[model samples]
Target: MKTTRKILLSAGSVLVLLLTFYLVWANTGLGSETKQSLKIDATASYGDSSNKGNVVGIQAFVEPVDYASEANFRRKIRFYMEEAKKKNWLIPNKSIVVFPEYFGTWLVALQEKERIYSTPEIEEGMQTMVLRNAGRFLATFLKCPQDVQDKLKYSVFAMKAEVIARVYQDTFASLAKEYKVTIVGGSVLLPDPVVENGLLKTRGGLLYNTSVVFETDGTINPQLIKKAFPTADELGFICPVKPEAIPVFNTGAGKMGVLICADAWFSEAYQTLKSKSADFVITPSYSNGYGYWQQPWSGYSGSKTPEKAKADVGKISLGEAWVKYAMATRAKEEAGIKKGINVFLQGKLWNLGADGSTIVLSDSAHATPFVGKSALINLWL
Candidate 1:
């Protein structure tokens, strides 16, 4: 009996030690060993390349992101810029290149374990991220009582807010300086983002989907554009900011007004731009799910669909709704805007299916939409 008890105790001790080791290993930051490379296979272009437009819209159809390291992400993004350089689409100081929405939001997964990248579902990856940083995440989660609907998402953004800002700002700023062109660095979900001394910083508050614009000299614009309309999916986590005035940035390319995706559907958005006398408008947008563009229109995503847009809700497809109601339709008619750039992000992220045709409008008429990966849609201003 004594020998048996000793044997059982030894086994239990060994088991406990094994569990401890496994927990430490699972939480430890194990960098990804997989070398990622972006292939430009489904390359397509719209508009006349010979026209040499001062404004270029990069239909950055990216693949499933691998946030193993910051450098990997930069390497992948650089491919798009390099491709533009080779085609002479980018002209230093004379060109403004716009990217699609949610371009930097994925930075939340930066420097995660290999498992995070290999997970088939994005939720699983985020779970791993939370598990790895449970203590910090829980602290953040408790701090955000105001965001009862999306406290989990709020916690994720809040816990890693600083790092997300750093990677996102630094990446775009460096790229703009390196390419010597004005870059609208898509959008990132940050808590009350503000520009101070030419750097993007976040104050602890409700998260907002914000877009940052970098000048040719790499200085961030003082005015940070926040999304006025949060989509149905975003409503739980994102807060719409009522700006005192929507800004029209004066750039070498032109007076540019940027309206985030869903905001383009509202007449008030265009009116704001019109009041500013914007020369051109760029709508950085994202459409989730596979083949959603072809799906039947579900009407305006956030808030109430303006009475004018209600009739077309069920009758038209989502793609058609964009052309008829979004920047393509509103830029010229309401804003008297000469050109409009509506760019969509393409690329499958786990179960998050991606679909949208990048549309470029000149004189309010949209060109043949480019539907494929790694495409460049340009309109000569």
Candidate 2:
């Protein structure tokens, strides 16, 4: 009887171990190959027929992220590129393409369980992810700054930093090379990211909103474009840099400056770009909450409203304020930046919805906002 009981106990232990391994594998494994057929939901273009100098802005309409695999997220981006080619906006070595802000930031959810996309709150989803990957998260959490107020965000970002950097870099670089156009790879929240010999390397620290420029040949520019302003939503987790000169990328089309969303609100950012002799500027932006643009203006969400921008508050809607106070009106008048495009990320992700239309500025004149589901706004330089 004792020997029989020992054999049964040993068998039960083995079965329990196998069950644990299977659960881990099911949650962590990248699922089967998935493909999506996407088409351009909306399209708008400005300037003359000459495609010599084309600046294409993809107002990508994204969905609840299912980074069950990297290719799942990448397919959406690939569809935009394919659609751009059909529209003839993609010119070899002669055009630059811009995507909306935070396009790459959601990559942190990559390889997470399917339930992460269905959670009512992002915090809940993140907590679930951390629990499932407790060992990995704990390893990174220990290395994080204990002094930071939001340890969850800091630790999560630290744990996923390397994967986020690698996937973000590889996705944009390959797209840039394949499309043969300069790409302003949208911003990603990373902890002290540095490009070493054209490779992205992250040294864990305070997370900064960073963007990278990929040349036509898929090589990354060594200079990192860090966002100097962080909105109220980002204050607790994201580190904002001191006001400094914005970086400009020399492309085949022209010397272009980039401002990530709220960065375009300040005059100093535009002035800094002007001093560098930028031919045009691109603002990759994202406005959260559905119909949030129609609501009353909330003043500057980042820092105190500049003296020049004080009068516009309360008088205009949030959407109008964006045009009046942001790049469309201010870029040209303040910094002689006559040509630029303000592109916003559209579509919904979990409970966080997106708004904002595409604003194209050319030859000192801006277009009426193109409020479409998903859009392509092109300006011929």
lDDT of 2: 0.82
Clashes of each: 0, 0
| TM-score per model over all chains | 0.90, 0.90
> Which ten-residue region of model 1 has the weakest summed lDDT?
43-52
Native RMSD of candidate 1 (Å): 3.8
What would the per-residue lDDT of candidate 1 be over residues 1-381, giving only the tens digit for each residue? 999999999999999998888678666766576767566544434444443346767777654444567887788778888887887878888778888898888778777677877777989988888987777899888888575488888888778888989988888889999999899988898988899987889888889888889999888999989998889899988888763255789988779999989888888888899888889888899888888787789888767787888898888888888999888988888888867788888776667867788776774465345465657765667
Q: Model 2, 258-298: lDDT tens per residue?
A: 99899988878988888888889998998898887878887
